[model samples]
Target: MKKPSKCQSPGDSSISAKENDAQSNRSRDSKVAPKSEGLATGLDETEWKSRLTTPEIVLKEIRTLEGVSYYHGMVARDLVESKLTRCGDYLIRATDNRIMEFEFILSFFNKKRIHSHLTIKCDVEAGKWALGLLSVNQFSSVVDLTNFYKTNPIGAGFFLKRAISKGKYMIAHDRIKYSPKDDLLGTGNFSDVFRGKIELENQMVNVALKTTKLLDDTMDPTKNVKANKIKKEMIQEAEVMSQLRHANVTSFFGIAVDRLPILLIIEFCNGGNLQGHLIKFGDRIGTNERFLYLHDASAGLNYIHAMSITHRDIAARNCLISVNGFVKLSDFGMGLKVRRNESAEKVAEDDDGKENKEPKLPVRWMSPELVDTPDAFSKMSDMWSLGILAYEIFTNATKPFFNLDDTDVMQTVKSGKHPPLPLSMGPDLIRLLKDVLVAAPTQRTTADKFYNELHVLCTQKGALSLNGLTINQIRGISRKRVEHVTYRKLSYAIRMVTREIGVMHHRRCWLMLFGGERSEVSSRTGSF
Candidate 1:
């Protein structure tokens, strides 16, 4: 068994002696010419071969019969359908797309450019398959093509199995099963999010399942096209989600494609979103507690920025609060990866200007630059949203630029005016908001630096608690009273320890702490 050279043509002497000699000379010259000199000219035994950008297997057959004429190759196999086109004097194009035996004809028409004058022929027969060719240079083999459609955030779309095996975050869709009729968490243009459950590491946990609508079986052609577009967008969102894993970021379990409308299984937050939390708890929550949520949101934003991602839509509604009081950022429809030296306008805007129509953007939260060019979303633009988020938190979910339309908000921001800080906000919190809310995107503070500053302010405000007591609560206690409470606790611990252990063992514990032999300690205490 021997492999063939690239563009190798078989021998044929059916043409005139002069043409045969010309063909022979060209064959010899082709061997010596640079392989990069892909296409050359000659007749029936000539080996002027150009490397077709076809699949590896298809190229092999094409090279085996490059010298054969088109007429004879077609007659040799009796193929159901065939096509021929004279691209130039040097090249001939042939294509076949019939669901029949695996027989491929490889031949070309003679140089006289007459359909009746067929000079040579070669036949290739192999295993069975049929592929339609939209172009002469493209080929799709069984091994290279998969029936299933799949995509991820950072790589080319591939078969479902390959996607799962290749990506670190990808999981098999079969591993997830959801209730057909469940409480719908939310709905979007092309998807409906439902509360579902999935088995993770042998534990059944609640998850949010976002499923894309079925487009393949749509009755309307227009809707079918739109559905496909939405499916791609959702897959892109899933791709970004798979790459991310942070304490303050929502977790993506995997994609469920075992059925219609691909499903994205994600971690469920019991406390809902920051928007609802503020609206419900409003006046009952203190300023310090609100700062804690702000800190969490900032931490998430910083993590995403470190990974070079711009969460184009950042607002209170996009932030989720866990039942345990942890805040995680969610919703990644407008997320985009930053490229080196790319301008905001190029990276942020969709080329088609379709993102502006459906799936509305946060108008009041958007920065001046983003307002002008929606695609100009950057880390700085995210900072602007963070400012709005802070205001929403402090004001108990009050809408930014309340009662003002999109135009009003844009004009006000451009005029160097911003929402006033809530009366409850201290000087430090107000300063942090000012840094993020600057009209100029370039002047805005970085997410990490802003996060650090807010963290410090949070600590200063006694937003952090120690052993169930906030610093403020602890401050109100008198020193003598605190000492009395500490002494009582100490006595209680000693009594409990003595009851749990025998007297001899308890004496040994004291001796170990005091750096004395148990015998000596017992003698001094006159106990054991």
Candidate 2:
């Protein structure tokens, strides 16, 4: 299988892992694979034992072939999707029950940005393998079959060319080592997070280890029955996360499954979550700082939308603050990949057979449409949440509709009612909020446009601010002013432009612009 990229970027959040699910028998379901090292080396003991142990290393003995994409454990469906990035990107893995009708899996990326995971048929007596339930084309070995398909396209015009290999960051080994963890970051219903250093061969990367509590319940037979179901969902989320590459989005390190105490590891952001950061340091965040935060967030969201992933839950709490102060979107437990002309499947698909439980929805952050059809989250819904996020930043991170209960808040939210700008960031923010906080989804501004506007807004240095000035006074000014000299005037943000020019000159310039008498408008000098 292709490796997940280590490049940094941004995106959004989560809560419900899944609906009661069952073990899905589907094959590959990803759309990423770069021209890569492929299988740099044969599958060694370290690789084989990490994934599958019970099967007895029959394939490991075939040292001549260590082709990538072959797996021996569970969640092969997810693993395949995470790694396949391009057309023909493929992998083959041993089926959970190889002795059954199907012996292996052949998964590859499709040009349509979807993925295909096909079951491979085998004739044990003939020592041959073929595609699907039956195929006229047969090969002596799995590697030979994969090689043939690289040049020959398969179902729906997909070519199995670039076989994926797990890079250093994505740990699949059950016994992979790491340093003793320290510094508890946070906790949730199903996990406890701690800051730690993960051991890689060449170096140690800072990481946040979130231990999954659901799978550790060994005493409950009922729980064990849905273990694979839960793992499949978890694996699906991690795989989707694996494809995220942005500085504003927290990176997924890997998950240690096929063992106890399965840890969901990711990049460590020491500044904690954006919501807590704002609550604790609201006084420190100002207009410029707020703009920077929004700018970073929008950049992340833009990338997320570009990738066709809808962050079902987007709020200040879901955004993480890096130590360097960049806003990164994280906590993607509820993300959904909404591809063009395709059904919007969630990262973790709902399983009808699993236990029934009430979903703890992020009501305040949700759009009205989501409340109506909870599963139908989209980019426009995310835009509505972005409007709330802007409100959070300007309001010093205060919770919106604090006066209303969650159930009651939905009434206000559903009616297209939102709080007015409680604090003055600028009119740019006001304009942004107006564009996003609309009842009609089509009326909302896209994250791409948000990013572009912020790009300009974030560059403002307050050298030409005209905030709070009357429209008449602004209209009165002509070409010879300080603003016309160097910078574009701010629409409505606090500016210390007068400080750049002398205060006397600033007053005189303003007076002169308004047609004040020569005596009233004092002689303004080019000199300070």
Candidate 3:
């Protein structure tokens, strides 16, 4: 019988071809292979075994592959080793049966290092042989490259070392790149936003990295819980943001969690936020400019709602502005997916009588149904918040419910009461606000409707060019002014409550000091 050929094996042929090509290329170039320098070099089996037994020799072997290719190779090797070791020859057979089904993911260290797209295929009989040994499912399933890398760093490291020996390994865009240093740009409840630079193929790009602390029982009790919650929230937000691609929304780069404190890289908006701009030029900005800002912000919110995502927190703080005065929605921390016919009752009941309640729903901007009933909020609720945001933009950063308590605000909303706006505001804007702030969720205007109407209004008002504001400008202005107003109102309310408590305390003290005399005086007054 003819000897079996390696080409008859599914992945084996490809593997052999790859190895042979490397060897042939190296020989033609007269280049020395790094592996040849090890104990295997010019040594018998017994000598090599002795050298391999030494820890120092093993360490030297590891140091040989210290680049990106080394890491990728290590990952691939680990994946192969793990599957083969666990399932044995069955896996080898499965690969042989369906070699073409497998995908080869080449992750580059840098974008420029990649010369061309990868092409992978397997031999038919080899694939069939592997499949006969293993189940079809095992051989046909796609592999997760990221998970493979996570488990097999050593094997990946080795492969990468060899692959990059002759040429530079290119980086892929999807791969996570490291920044030199963490520069703190903004701080939130659980995360500190950093301004970082990532090196791409030929140039470096600026990105905002939101780094959050990890939660562990070893940490302070209060902080541990808060950190965990924040981490979950950030993950959800990142997931939503990454899937979304829009000019009016902030772009989410990939997230990194390999290191403690997960990092969320995002496109850096150059223009300061809307709140910042308002502070600097509140007086200088014309009425048309303010109207344009509102129109742009509403447009963004409309896009989000159309995508079936609700921006529960639609305050000015979340609207980022670009240097060119374009507004993009940012900070999806409080966003929730609102599918049709979903019951909010379940979510509310799940949290019923819990120690930590849902982050106090944004009371000031929330619609009546959102506050009063366990109704899964609709797009209209977002529209209500948008109305509040529009009012803020137009009124030089003034907040709605500037003086109302949470209870009172809820009551007013339930009672269909809205904050007064200046008479100078046009009827079209007023009509749009009313439609959005309707007490019934069903009565609320749809985002598309709102955008269309607003666009028409802007055109009629000769303010069509307002869409040019950048994301940074919007965020800066919205953040500074809205946060200031919220905190300021909260402080004032606390002071008022404190004063009332003091007066009540004084009356009680007097009554306690002269209880008998006061009782006698009350009786005499009643007799007179």
Model number with the top lDDT: 2
Candidate 2 lDDT over residue span 1-528, tens digit each: 212111111111111122211111123324433322211111233332332322212232122232232542334465457767876677654333311111355666778777766666554445565675336677776677877887776755666667676443335432233322235576442345666665455455566766544443222333332444556666677766656655577767676542233456776776677787677766755566666667667877876675557786677877886544456787775233211112332122122234322224556777767655666778999999888898897777777777777667767777878767764866766876788888888888888777667666666655223232211122222212211111112211112455565545444443333321111001121110
Best by TM-score: 2
Tens-place lDDT digits, model 3, residues 354-383: 332222345566677766552456677778
**Residue ranges of candidate 2 with Cα displaced over 4 Å:** 1-72, 76-169, 173-183, 189-191, 211-229, 334-359, 461-528
Better of 2 and 3 by lDDT: 2
Give model 2 RMSD, 1 decimal: 17.4
* TM-scores, all models, native as reference: 0.53, 0.55, 0.50
* Candidate 1 per-residue C-alpha lDDT over 121-200 given as tens digits, one digit per residue, 9 for 90 to 100: 22123322222221111224322222211221112221122210112333433344454444567543333566766555
Ranking of all predicted structures according to lDDT, beginning with the best and ending with the worst: 2, 1, 3
Q: Name the better of 1 and 2 by lDDT.
A: 2
- Number of residue pairs clashing in candidate 2, backbone atoms closer than 3 angstroms, sequence gap of 3 or more or interchain: 24
Question: What's the lDDT for residue 215 in model 2?
Answer: 42
Alpha carbon RMSD to native, model 3: 24.8
